[model samples]
Target: MIHQIRIDNFKSLVDFEIGLSRFSCLVGLNGAGKSTVLQALDFISQQMRGDIDSWLEQRQWEPRDLGSKLTAKQNVDISVQVETEKHGLIEWSASFNRQSLRCTTEEAFCDGVRLLKVEDAEFWIDRSVKQGSLRDVRSEIMFEYQGSILSQLKRKQIGEPLQALKEVLANIRSLDLLSPEHLRQRTRDSAGHLGLGGQKLSAYLHEQGSEVRQRLLEKLQHAYPQLASIDTRSLRSGWKHLDIAEQFSGKVLSTPARHVNDGLLRLLAVLSQLASDEHFLLFDEIENGINPELVEFLVDALVESEHQVMVTTHSPVILNYLEDEVAKQGVIYLYKNAKGATQSIRLFEIPSLAEKLQFMGPGEAFIDTQLTELATEIQSLSAKGGKDVSAAKR
Candidate 1:
């Protein structure tokens, strides 16, 4: 799982570091760069799959677009250090040159030992030439930066650091489930792991065995008592469509997936993703269309899941619904200063606010502690700066 992340020269993040918990929620006022952070993670997740040049081209991003506009930085650098249970820190960086909009540097390391490091077209791997250390095993790995040099490691017989880094990369997944419309689409594509918008839900859920399907359905039904079961319908073209047994209008109805309410479908999408094998899940606007009352259920599911969930939410009720222990430990507040730079601090680190949470919900505690003033203050010397933010025990 991703233990901590350091982001610099990316979007509105400027230069900031964020720590992660098993499950976390990014709660803050608008324009705090919450969604931008999620976008950056998604970009890296896709880039890790290879074809970095093609990935940037697909989004029509210029060199200037990737770096922080808030500063005149020479490069765009994103580095993540994932901590494994037994092994030590594993790091990755696909740094880009701001002028050329090209990846000038890419590297990965395990326990401070270099696994792969690329500069332009040149790279070094673990020693295989029977000459020197792994860092001395140099090779040419550039295809005009179209993909990662790590892909080459996969093809060759690599060991340790590279294999460990590969597993870490595989665990990173970003989910964008805001589109209820996509979930309702008629798709022929394999319902592999629940895709970005859950568009492939029908295909994926249909392919699961009866036991797995029943287990997930039971969990979903627990949160939404109205739901009886989820099953697939055979369409004329030999394709299957998702349908759910729901008790509505005083009668049980087998509703087509497309016809179901957006809230139900969105929750269903989240459920499928949580049930999958992915370890790291990044979600933007996690409370989009769900009923407010069920917010706790969503929070509960995420916090209890085996996966490490990172999500952004505009809903204070979502934060308020969290239990004291979960709220104090799992919430990370994102705030924007007058100049529009984003900063983050976990609630557990703030003693004053943490104490207030024992008596009030997160929403009330936020207001009472003068955080609102700090966010909008033009020259706040107290509890406003990125790393120096403080509260004098209201």
Candidate 2:
């Protein structure tokens, strides 16, 4: 599991560190750096997958090089610390240059000593010219040219370490970015190992036999009593479909996996991922497209799983479902500071209120209490001549 992440000069993150828990929720308004955190994790995992170049390309690095452009002074420096049950401690750092539009230096450390550094020309050094200039210097450097530590360990026949890393990566899956169209295609294909968008749900289900399928059905039924049975079938045209029978009605209803509601599909995706042997899971916007009534069930299911789950949500409904113990375990609140930089504070760090009032519901209480407090602070500052004047006078 990732114990902490420290980001410097990465997009909006100038310098920030966040500690994690087994089941964590990151809540804040939009554009508050929530998605950036998920993307940062994705970048780390992609680097381990030997796809750092491709990942950098997605960020629009012109020269398509990482080692040549990423530097501590020129670009952003990112340091991540992950704690594992088997391997102990692993740390990774990379420098990204916004001006040069590339990553120049990349390094990985195990238990604090440098294990890998890929800035040499042999790993990556390409020639490229400016728009009208004829000169060319080392344009890009491939950080994972020798493959990731995880991949190298696997190739070396280190089964335990590879398994441990794989479990950690699997748990970092980000499903919220999945698109409806992508989900439809996956349902149509019935592929296994459902990707972020659940495009592989059908395939995964199709690969399973009656026993495993029945087990999944049972698990789903246990979480959702309304679901009588869940089954998968392949058509002659090579399309796969999921059949969901409602408990109240005996009639069996079928929907092309694509036709399923977003909420239902999202819930299934979460459950399927949690059911895997992964040790940690991080979810952004956990409440997106999910029903309020099912939030509690979803939380319960997550709690039952052996893997640690971290979810980011703005919904009090979802927060309410979390047990007090779990809530106190690792809850983080993301807020923008006076300088417009994003920072995180532990939810428990906030003082309990006096004259507590009974809330109609968790959602209501969250808005009336937590959110209201922040809003009131903002209002008070605005009334006192806003941020600019206040700062100038001080």
Candidate 3:
């Protein structure tokens, strides 16, 4: 799971860092750079998959658009710390050159040992370490890779630590752009995971095993008690379609995906992604179309799930539903410093906020307090040119 992230020269985020829990929620006023937090994670995932140029295309951004506008820096840097079952803790950082649209530098370390390092067109990897000494076995690659040299390395050539890091980065999934129109469309692709917008949800369901599908249906029934069963079938055009069987007055009524309500379809999409094999999930504006009661249910489900989940919300109801313990550590507040760069701190760390939480719901406390005032208090408490200790609290 991802433990922490630090980003520099990336849009509104300049020297920004935030720690994450198993289930976290980002809350802040508009333009506080909440969505950019999710985008940073997606940016890292895109870098791992391919070159910077391709990622810019996905976001419809230009080469120069990658850097933070607040500064003249031409390179965007992102660092991630992840905890793996086999490798323990691994820290990886990469620098992307805006002009070249390629990774200028990349480095990774496991247990304080360098696993991979790249500078310019050359790269080095320490294949193994014994007795705290680097082994004589080292591999060198001299070439200019488009995106990440670490990602380009063959799995057979790298050891288990590097492999585990790659897997974690590859599994970082973002659903910040789920579209109802795409969810209603029928597609022929049977992707192992749901597409970013859930466009291939039908195809994805088609690929799930029987046991997995059964588990998904049971979970969905919790939100839609009338949903008797879910079925997917191959169409004549080779596309797959998803249909729902609803029990009505002792009879069954089948409804196609296109006819499903916005809230129900969105809920189904969320549930399906939760059941997927992805390690991390990011949701933006999680309360968009869902009812309050269903939003409560979604929150409960997210907390109960094992995956690392992060969501941004404007709904106070979402906060009110969270248990005190979860809110204490899982809620992160994003704000802007006097320099207009994004800054983050746990909501519980705000002075007197913890005391207020004891008397009021987290939602009420958030609504009553002014985030700007809180941000000012934090800025004064923290020293200049110092590490953000608030981010390290997690």
Alpha-carbon TM-score of each model against the true structure = 0.84, 0.72, 0.93
Higher-TM-score candidate of 1 and 2? 1
Model 2 gets an lDDT of 0.57
Residue-level lDDT of model 1, residues 1-394, one tens digit each, is 7766666788887766677777778776777777877767766665456555555674577646777768877776767777776556778887766555455688777756666667857777763222246555677763543334554456354655556665666556666545888788766655366566676778777776567778878888867888878888668785768888978878988988778889888888788778887778888898888888888899888888899888888767777767777776668877765556777767545666667777788867865766565444423434456535522100
Deviating ranges (above 4 Å) for candidate 3: 51-54, 129-144, 383-394
TM-score of candidate 2 against the unseen true structure: 0.72
Which structure is stronger by TM-score: 1 or 3? 3
What are the RMSD figures for all models against the true structure?
4.2, 9.3, 2.3
- Cα displacement (Å) at residue 155, model 3: 2.1
Model 1 residue pairs with clashes: 127-134, 191-204, 383-390
Q: lDDT tens string, model 2, 35-140? A: 6666666655554555454545645554222321122445556666667776687665665545443335665555544444446432221111112221222233
TM-score of 3: 0.93
lDDT of 2 at 141: 40
Candidate 3: tens digits of C-alpha lDDT, residues 90-133: 99999987776667888889889888777745666776532243
Candidate 1 RMSD to the real structure: 4.2
Give candidate 1's error at residue 360 in angstroms: 2.3
